[model samples]
Target: MPSRILFVHVCIVVFLFSVPLAFGAQSTADVPVTKELREKALKDILGKTKELPKIEKEYVIGHGDYLRVQVYGEGDMAAADISIGGEPRSADAPRQGRGVKVQLDGRISLKHIGDVEAVGLTLTQLADYLKILFATVFDDPVVTVVLEQSNSQRYTVMGKVANPGIFFIDYPITLVQVIARCGGFTEWANSEVTVVRKGAEENKLFKKNIMKFDYDDFLEGKKVERNIFIKSGDYIIVH
Candidate 1:
C-alpha cells in the first residue's frame, strides 16, 4: 500500500505539469494571426518603406534666394551685375556688385537685361544663360553665378521629440537620420510618425502629400524599408 500510494503521488505530479504545458501550447495556437492584423501588417509595408532611387542632387534656384552674378574684367559695366552691394576697388577687381534677391515673381532685374527668369535653373545653367544675355553689353563677357543665401532647402520637426524645430538640409537625408538630427524621440513619443509634405507632387511612394512612417516597426526589422528620405519643406511630426 505504501508503494502504491507513492506511485499515485508521482502520477499526479506528472499529470499536473503536463496539463499546463499542453494548455499553453493550445492557447498560443488559438490566437492565429487574424486577417485584419495581416492586412494591417502588409499595408504598413506596401508602397511605404522602399528606398527611393538615387535622385539628382543638383540644387535648383528658388524664390527668396540671394544670387551674386559676376562678370570678370567688366567693372565699369559692373553696375549691371547682380550681387551684394559694394563698389569694385578697380576695373579688374572681382565685381562686388549689388546683390539681387530673387523676387516673389521668380525673376531678377539686371542693369541691362532687365527682369530675367532665375528660378528653376541651376547655377551653371543660369551662368550660361546670363553669358548670352550679357554678350550684347560686354565683349566676350565671363559670367559666374553664386548662391549667396539659401532659404528654400529647409524642413520642420514638431511634437514629442527631444528637439523640435525648423532644420536646414544641404543634402538628401532619411527620416531616421532627421530624427537623430533633432535629438531623437521624447520619452513619451509615439512610434507612429506622420510626415506632412507641402507643395510636393503626388507619387507612388507618397500619396495625398502625406507619408506615414513607422519608426518602431522599422527598428524591429519588420518594416525595414520605411526609412524614407526627407525632402525640402517637409514637416515631421512624432506623436
Candidate 2:
C-alpha cells in the first residue's frame, strides 16, 4: 500500500507539470498562419500602401517668402551692348544670385523693378517676370530669382505631443518623421493620430480628407505604413 501511494503521488506531480507544457503547444498552434491568411495579408499590404509622391515640387511663392533677386546686365547700365544673359557672349555661365523679400502684400520691391506681383509664380517664373519689369530701366535685363525662405509648405501639429506647433517642411517628409520633428508624443498620447487635409473633391464644392494614423505602429518601425507623405495643407493632430 505504501509503495502504491508513493507511485500515485509521483503520477500527480507529473500530470500537474505537464499541463502547462501541453497548453503552450496548443496555444502556439491555435493561431496557425495558413497559406490563405498569408495571401490575404500580402493583398492587404499591397492595397493599403500606395507609392508616396515625389517630395520636391515646384514651390509656389506666397507671402512672407524671402526671394533672392539678381538683374545681371543692368549693373553695367548698357547691358544689351555688353552681354546676352548677364555674361559676355563668349563666356560659359552667369553671375551670382541676389535676394529680395516678398512683402505682406505679395509683391517684391526691387530697386529698379519696384513692386512686381510675385505671390503666384515659381522662382523661374518670377525670374521671367522680373526680367520684363527690369526692361523698363535697363537694356535687356537678365533676372534670376531664388527663394531664400518659404512659409507656404507648412503644417500644424497639435494635441498630446511634447512640442506642438506649426512646422515648415521643405523636403518630402513622412507623417512618422513629422511627429519626431514635433518632439514625439507625450505620456498620455495614444495611437489614434489624425491628419486633416484640405482640398477639393471631384464632385463636391469643398472637401477635407481626414485620415487616422497609428503612431504606435509607426513606433514599431513598420516600413510600409509609416511612409505616408505630408501634403501641402495638412494639419496633424496627435492623440
Candidate 3:
C-alpha cells in the first residue's frame, strides 16, 4: 500500500511540472503577433519615426558660402558675393567676381564694413547685426543678408534603406520625403521606422503596418497623416 502511495505522489509531481511546460510553450507562440500589434500601435502615434541625433546650433563658416548684404535705404552695399579667404585683391582684379572665404577666425571682411563674424548667426539675425553696425555710420541703415550657396546645411540618413548618405536640404523636409529620396525600403524592411532627431534626450521610434490600410483608400489620399515631417539630422531605421 505504501509503495502505491509513493508512486501516486511521484505521478502528481510529474503532471504538475508538465502542465507548466505546456502553458509556457503556448505563451511563447503568441508573442510574435503581440509584438506586431504593439508595433502597429506605435506607428499610429509616431508616424514615420526615426532616431534623432544630438543637434547643436554652432555655426562653422566654410568655403563656397555666398552672402548677400543689403543696407536698407542706403542701398550702396546691396550686393551678393562668395567667401574666398586671402589677401586683399589687387586694384586691377575684377570687382564683382571671386568667392569670399571665411577667415581663420570665422570672420568676413566687407568693403567699408570691415571684419564681421559670419559664423553662428543665421542670415536674418546676421542682417540685423549688420544693420546695427552700419547704423553707427549710416542713418537708419536697413540690412538684409541672403545665402546663395552654403556647405553647412546638411543631414544624414541610414539603416534599411536602398541608399544611405548625407543629404543637403534648402527647405523644410518630411520623414516620408527623406525615405523616398533614399530609394525606399528593402524586402526585409519593417513597416516600423525610427528617427533620431537633433537635441532630443532619447531616440523616437515609429512603426507603420502596411496590412491595415486599404489599397484604394490610401491611393485616394485618405491617409495622409502616415507621412510625418522630418527634421534635420534624422536617422531612419526600417526594421
Candidate 4:
C-alpha cells in the first residue's frame, strides 16, 4: 500500500510540472512569432521610402492654368484689363493683372496674336515664344510670362484623412506639407502611408509605381529625406 501511494504522488508531481512546461513552451513560441511578424510588417511599410529620388523638373504648362502675360510697352496686350477669352473686364479690376485663365483647348487669347498655344511650354519658353510672335507688331518686343495660379497640376488625397479630395498644387510641396494641407489624419489612421505615382519609372528603387512612408518615423526626425515632393497626378493614401 505504501509503495502504491508513493508512485501515485510521484506521478502527480511529474504531471503538474510537465503541464506548466508545455504551456510555457507554447507561450514562448507564440510571443516571438507575433513580435517578428509585427517588426517585419513595420519594416516593409517604411522601407519603401528609402530610395526615392528628388523631383526637380521645371513646371510645364497645361490646361486650366492661369498666366500673367506682360509686354514692356503694350498695356492692351497685357492681362490687366483683358479677361480670359477676350471678355470685358470691370472698371474696378486690379491693375496688377488677375491673369488669363487657360482655355480647355490649351490656348490663351491675346490682343494681337489671338489664341496662342500655351500648353506643354515652360514659363520661359512661353515668354521667348511670345517675343517671336509679337515681333510682327513691335520692334524688338520684350515679353514676360508668369505662372500666376496653376490649376492644372492636381493631386488626390484619400483614405483616413480629414479632407479626402483632389487638391491643386502650384509649387513643389513635400509629403508633410501635403498632409497638412489635406487637414491631417483621421482618428483611426495609422502612421503608414502609400503614394501611387502615375509616371514613376520602374527600377530597383521603385516597385509597381508605389512608395511608402512612416509618418511617425518622419515626425521623429528619422529619414527626413524620404519626405519626397508630391507630384501631380499622385494619389496619397493614408493607412
Task: Please name the candidate that would achieve the greatest TM-score relative to the true structure.
Answer: 4
Q: RMSD, model 3, all Cα superposed?
A: 29.0
Candidate 2 residue runs with Cα over 4 Å from true position: 1-56, 75-98, 200-208, 219-226
Q: What is the C-alpha RMSD of each candidate to the true structure, in Å?
A: 29.0, 28.6, 29.0, 30.8
lDDT of 2 at 148: 64
lDDT of 1: 0.76
Question: Between prediction 3 and prediction 4, which has the larger lDDT?
Answer: 4
TM-score of each: 0.59, 0.61, 0.49, 0.65
Q: Which stretches of candidate 3 lie over 4 Å from their true place?
A: 1-65, 72-106, 136-139, 201-226
Deviating ranges (above 4 Å) for candidate 4: 1-56, 76-97, 202-205
Candidate achieving higher TM-score, 1 or 3 = 1
| Model 1 alpha-carbon miss at residue 55, Å | 6.6
lDDT of 1 by residue, 70-168 (tens): 787664222344545475453223332246667789987776778889899999889889989999988777788887766557888999988888776
Q: Which candidate is the best by lDDT?
A: 4
Question: lDDT of candidate 3 vs native?
Answer: 0.60
* Rank ordering of all candidates by lDDT, starting from the highest: 4, 1, 2, 3
Give one digit per residue, the lDDT tens place, for model 4 in 1-239. Answer: 99999999999999999999999986763353454686667668769666533435668998877788878877536433534344325322222225776778999888788889999999988988998999998987778888876677888888998877787775679988988887899999999988889768753334788888899999899877768888888888999
Candidate 4: worst 10 consecutive residues by lDDT?
88-97
Error of 1 at 41 (Å): 47
Candidate 2, residues 145-205, lDDT tens digits: the string is 7766565567788999888877766678988888888788899988778877765244131
Error of model 1, residue 87, in angstroms: 26
